[model samples]
Target chain A: MSTSTSTSLTAPTASRVAGTAVLLGLTLAPFLLGPYAVATLSRILVFALLALSVNLLTGLTGLPTLGQSAYFGVGAYTAAVVAKNLTDIGPLQLLIAAGVSALVAVPTGWLAVRARGVVFLMLTLAIGEIVYSAAVNWKPVTGGTDGISGVPPVVPLPGTPALELDGLVYFYVLAVFLLLLGAVTRLGSTPFVLALRGIRDNEPRMKAIGYPTRRYALTVYCGAAALAGAAGSLWVSVQRFVSPGDAGFEIAALALLAVVIGGTGSMWGACAAAALIWLTRDYLGNLEAVAGRGPLLLGLLFVIAVYTLPRGLAGVRLPHQPSRKRTA
Target chain B: MAGWLDGNLVSVVDGIAFGLLLFTIAVGLSLVFGMMDVLNLAHGTLYLAGAYTAYALSDGTVPGLLLALAAGALVGALGGAALTLLTQPLARRGHLDQAVLTLGITFIVADLLAAAFGGEVLPTDPPASLRGTVDLLGHTYPVYRLVFIAVAAALALLVHLVFERSSLGALVRATVADRDMVRAQGVDIRKVLYGVFAFGAALAAVGGVLGAPILGPGPGVDESVLVLSLVVVVVGGLGSVRGALAGALLIGQVQTLGVALLPQYAPFLLFGTMLLVLVVRPHGLVPSAVRT
Candidate 1:
């Protein structure tokens, strides 16, 4: 609360510097680290993508949604279904997953865009649960909770070698992550995204000024869903399996929490927070001594973040941002 | 003719009973959100605490349940007061801060609970006095459910009378309508906020304790309760008691009837009903006039 004001006004340069440094460092991490570390980094990247997708809605558009799992599931299923039957072209799978997710978001976002604020949050949570149940129940296609396992490793390019279960797939995943992260960053900087920020700040004024607020909102929502779908596909590629739990409420909730903790409008902050959450949940959570207390630790981190670093990991503080303003 | 009439009667009674249970849990959410404009995501945690209390206190005896009720209410009130006090500093910061802050609290409490309770569903049984079943139209129904209905209905009546009839209720409503005006009238709005929050939390815990036999306590009961309460609050329209009752009954029947009739699609049916309701009445079935 204390630091929110000045950071918002001065965050552009600071965030850019931090973003580039983190991206470069992450891209170089796998090469320097061992196989186990590479695998962990791959998971972190997937989570980063998921958290960034959440930021697209919550931080950029002020939607505060808890439904990224819907898109994430779509991506995972797309990759799994394609890997099971069609080609294991990772790029193609990503595209199909994104497309399918965006398609589903059309009507879902239409219904969701009707409400704003807490109601919007509730609707998204319901939608996520419904989609998750469908995946759990729709047996033939979704594999009915068993999930589509035995997904083949993505076939490498014609000249290159295939990425078998070895550490080779890590590089491929890294490339895909970099490309998607770049695109998301570009998307966030676009005028269309600027319009979304405007909607987040003041919808009525935007509409009064003749901006087609609903259309813009729906578009952004679908786009973010597509990003989440891409992340899911990437998840499948790395894990080679998809489960109902992959699209469960915890993922959606964590992604939202990451965005909130990472400074809402800061993409780099989201990715950083995602990594933090992933490390906490996956690495620290699995420690033998701590046992099953990962959630407790993460919860403590959240409380600390709220109290100490209101701007989240990227630290994009707002300058005299008015409190008690109308929010959804 | 007798069989047809009997079946319909059974469904109606069952629906009302389920609705009453929902009302007991959801009214707390409605009052807290409506009156204080505080979106307490941890509302479900209080219910979870209450359910756990019931689990801890019950020895399959009536006196045990009475003790659980007292403990649940006390813990809930304390929890609510703590939440209000902790959040007062950021109350002026807006809903985003409040949301994040409460979410943090929810996560912390959920983890602590999971640790304490071993991450497994804990079954809780009603007292011996409320156990067993009674015959209804050639079908047997749990007697505890019937008791739940009676007790919940009475609680509802008490709540309605307190809010709609009592002068204290008038003051609370006055604060909700215009905080500055109530303060101008020499009423301490802060005290009212704390009291309402604590009281609402106590009510949620009480519902959790009473309904534990049916809903049960588990690792993720907090999330489920939170989601259900959200649905109830939304469908009932943010802060109105009548709205909360109507929404809870509608959802309660939807849950039981949908699961009974269409087991495969029960979850979807619940969501579908919610989607339909939202589409038809975006503000909810009963919107609060003062709050939004």
Candidate 2:
């Protein structure tokens, strides 16, 4: 809703140039950075995709869900299973993962979209926990807590060599990330997204205006699930291992947090915030001085961010969009 | 048939105890959410803090248990007051913001608790006098569990009577219904809010102190307890004590009996029951007459 006010009809030339510069930097980063850094960047991109999926529901559709991890886990497990039993074609794995995730989302999203606000949040939380429990209990399929390991390297194309090298994997992840990112950007201008925003702002009004609000909500929910699942599949390709922990509450919470910290409704903001959060937990946590204090520091970050960054990182400043109006 | 009854009797009793414990915890959460429109995600942290208090202060004596209860209640009250301060500013921002803020608090408090108590599940014992077993339905059950059932049942009854029967309860209800009108009549509505928040939090902490022996203190215990309480609150109707009791008892039975009967499908059973209930009663089983 606030985004609609700032992003008026005319395209802001400055922001476009800035966005291009950022994309150029990202494209060249793998070559400039070390293998470890490239791998981290690749992981960040995967998490960013997951965060973007969360933004679709929370930011765009006004559905605050803590269940994206369910689809993410589903995608990861599906990919792992596919890699172990079938061919390791990356695109094929991603497609299956997204399809299965979307299929699973239909019923769950139907139930979830029926409720509004806190009730909806509770339902999603329950669904997430249930999925996590399934991951832990379905030992034969998910390998229980140990998860499915020894996943074969991903082949970008059917005839191509497997991408075993970290840099090559990063490239594969980057390519998929960019494709999905562009697709999502294109989707933002569609009538469907406008309908979703209308639903978010006022469901009753949208319904009165002849919009099938629930159908739109469910559609976005499934789309978001598919995106999260795609991210999960990419996660398996990058890590070469899938565990129950990958689909746990922490992942769901962090993804939601990243979306909030990035400023709701801004896709690029969500991606950047996801990277910051991932680095805070993964890179900063591994530092010798802060070793084992990751959760403490992360908790502090959450507190400070919620208090300080009310509108999130995206709300900071872009020549195009003005700062959010402070209501209180 | 006699053998089957005997086999299920223990689980049935365990279900009652578990259900009562849930009632103690969830009633507070239900009341706070219903009355104040604040989704306190850190409610479980109060329970965790109370359990930790029991672990720290219990000396295996009756007095020790009482002390733990008092301390737990005090800690909960203080924590509740602090939460009130934190959430009051964001009252106008909507429940989502409140949820996020409280979730942050949950994270901070849980991390602090883990730092202090370590990550291991600390199993606590009941007071020495209540340690032994008692014969029930031709089977032996722990004396502490039976005592817990009795105490929790009494507590539930007290809460029901206080909230449903007393003038103070009337005042609280009136405040929830029309805070501006209540304030217009010279009632210090802020005090009422603070009192409700503190009392509800205290109840959760007391539940934690009593339930520590059953659930134990652990790293992820806060999360599990939070989920269970949320389920109970949702199933029982958000603001009503009777609803909380009914929801907790049903979930308790489903948890204990379902696990005992169908160990492999226990997880699905919990969510299945929730799904079934939500489908039938979208507003919960016994929605409050006064809608928020």
Candidate 2 residue-wise lDDT, B1-292, digit = tens:
9888788999989999999999999999998988888888899999999999999999999999999999999999999999999899877666666666888788778888888899899999999999999999788999999999999999999999999899999998887778889999998888988899999999999999999999998888888888889999988888888889889998999999889999878878887777767766777877543221
| Off by more than 4 A, model 2 | A1-11, A318-328, B1-3, B288-292
Lowest lDDT block of 10, candidate 1 chain A? A318-327
* Docking quality level of the chain pair in candidate 1: medium
Write one digit per residue (lDDT tens) for candidate 1, span A1-328.
Answer: 3656664746767757866897788767766888777888888889989998888888888898888899999889988898789878888888899999999999999999888988888889889989999999998899888988999888756445558853678778888888988888777567898898889888899999999999998998999999999999989889999999998988998898888788777887888888888898888989999878887878778778777875566664555445423445
> What are the TM-scores, per candidate, against the unseen true structure?
0.93, 0.94
The best candidate in terms of DockQ: 1
How good is model 2 by TM-score?
Answer: 0.94
Could you give the CAPRI-style class of model 2?
acceptable
